[model samples]
Target chain A: MAKPACKNLEEIFRTPHGAVYQCNRANCFWLEFAGGISAFKASDFLHLKKQVEQIDVPEMVQNTARMADIVILNPFRSERCFVLTVTDVLNLRELLQGAKVMLDLNSMLYDCLHAMAV
Target chain B: MKDLLRLRTSLTEEIETLLNEQIKVEAHSSSVYLAMSSWCNRNGFDNSADYFQKQSGEEREHMLKLFGFINDMGGRAISPEVTNIPQEFESFRAVFETALQQEIYVTQQFNRIADRCFKAKDFMSFQFIQWFLKEQIEEEYIARRALELFDVIGEEGTGRWEIDKQVPKIKYEN
Candidate 1:
């Protein structure tokens, strides 16, 4: 037996800034953002999505403080840190939301298929 | 390709979100009960304070039970940050009234979650919450009985003292 040289990745969602992929072989999600790819387990991915959704976008836009210009996310079990600006946060939110909807659709479809198979 | 999402968790995203919200509710209820305990203690209602402290601990136990279930099902269980706990009471009677109201609210929340579980066809989660739904009956009964003591004892001269003494004795049998 031979292991596949390339990752068995399925594109979940993509935007001009980045994209997300589901790695079937690794059983994790690959986030293509900030000019690199970072892997997150399913739970970690959902956690990241929640963190992104909680960002105060309006406050970020209104606050002039240098520290308030960006927010950082350090995903669990990953060395990468996402330092996101207001625009980056918006883009990431869009990406993650799209991916979540697709994942939910996939699950529903799977249930339907399984029921039909039976 | 593999169904990675299904492989990751037995809970649907909707059910998981509802469970997390319920976790927050439980944490909030625990904090509220602890605040009530402190108010009762400060007002010289020793037995009532002890009763509320016990209620607070039970609510925390309920929260941990939900937390464990979420994690066991492979869903992310968030440790909720509770806020807005009231520390002051208007009067002695107000405390038991608030307790009864809080129990009612908790029962309503559990009913909503159970309904959502049924709609989503998540029978496992529905079955898990039945314990809480049934427990709410006893909780509401105890709180209601404690409140009714104010009317029975007549909060005039020694009524408050008598009510405080009897508060801890109130129990839900069967």
Candidate 2:
């Protein structure tokens, strides 16, 4: 039996700054970051991961401009925005990378279990 | 928990990415054909210009087919941004040579996509791409035949004009 509060949400990965959860009922991922929770569809989540990974940390570090110290992301189909600093970006990257690895592992497990069932 | 990812999309990430890449390839091919059409028209090869226009339209149709299929399967279809289209050609024969090369590249891309679909066990996409694979036979055939026109009719005096006139007649029966 699942916990009552988390009946629909499954924790995929966690870090000190943030964590990733999947809502099986909604078929979306719930991102706990920046003192808020944003829900993203699976494909949107992958796109967001790509956007974050594409951030150039070295450029941000080298540039003396204040704006260069951070990056902004407006996720698709969402009103919420992420304004992340270089440190924040690194943390988020770690969180997302962990979640992606967990997701891949889950997919492999699902395939194996289904193959056995078949 | 239920597999939310699989529930959200029928396409695996790898397959989805590959399909999007193919979409870009098709769009780029369409743009290149359109540029070829323009070059032919500027060079006064009217028949070859029309042929390339028709080919461009067909390539756009192919792009749309892949785009529709991706969306139908609950995957995102990206509208590709095409660049680096050549605006000029060296000579009349060079145009047909480039066209044939483009067709061959497109066939190779479709073959790669089919191979990926097979490996992923996504038989639906594999079956869908079979139409493209078969269409490639006609595409490559027509392009090859048009290029052969330059060889059959030497490009010395009125040879280019004759080749341009016969370009529209090149057909693939099978």
Which structure among the candidates has the greatest lDDT? 1
Each candidate's TM vs. the true structure?
0.92, 0.90
Model 1 Cα shift for residue B54 (angstroms): 1.5
Lowest summed-lDDT stretch of 10 residues in model 2 chain B?
B1-10
Instruction: For residues B100-171, write the lDDT of model 1, one tens digit per residue.
Output: 999999999999999999999999999999999999999999999999998999999999999999998887
Any runs in candidate 2 off by more than 4 Å, and if so which?
A1-5, A61-65
In candidate 2, position B137 carries an lDDT of 98
The worst-scoring run of ten residues by lDDT in candidate 1 chain B lies at: B1-10
What lDDT is reached at residue A42 by model 2? Answer: 87
- Give me candidate 2's interface root-mean-square deviation: 1.6
- Model 2, residue A104: C-alpha shift (Å): 3.0
DockQ of all predictions against the true structure, Cα-based: 0.68, 0.59
Candidate 1 TM-score, true structure as reference:
0.92
Please provide, for model 2 over A17-115, each residue's C-alpha lDDT reduced to its tens digit, 9 standing for 90 to 100.
888998887888988887878889888998899799999999999999988988999998877799999999999999998998898788779999999
Best candidate (score: DockQ) = 1
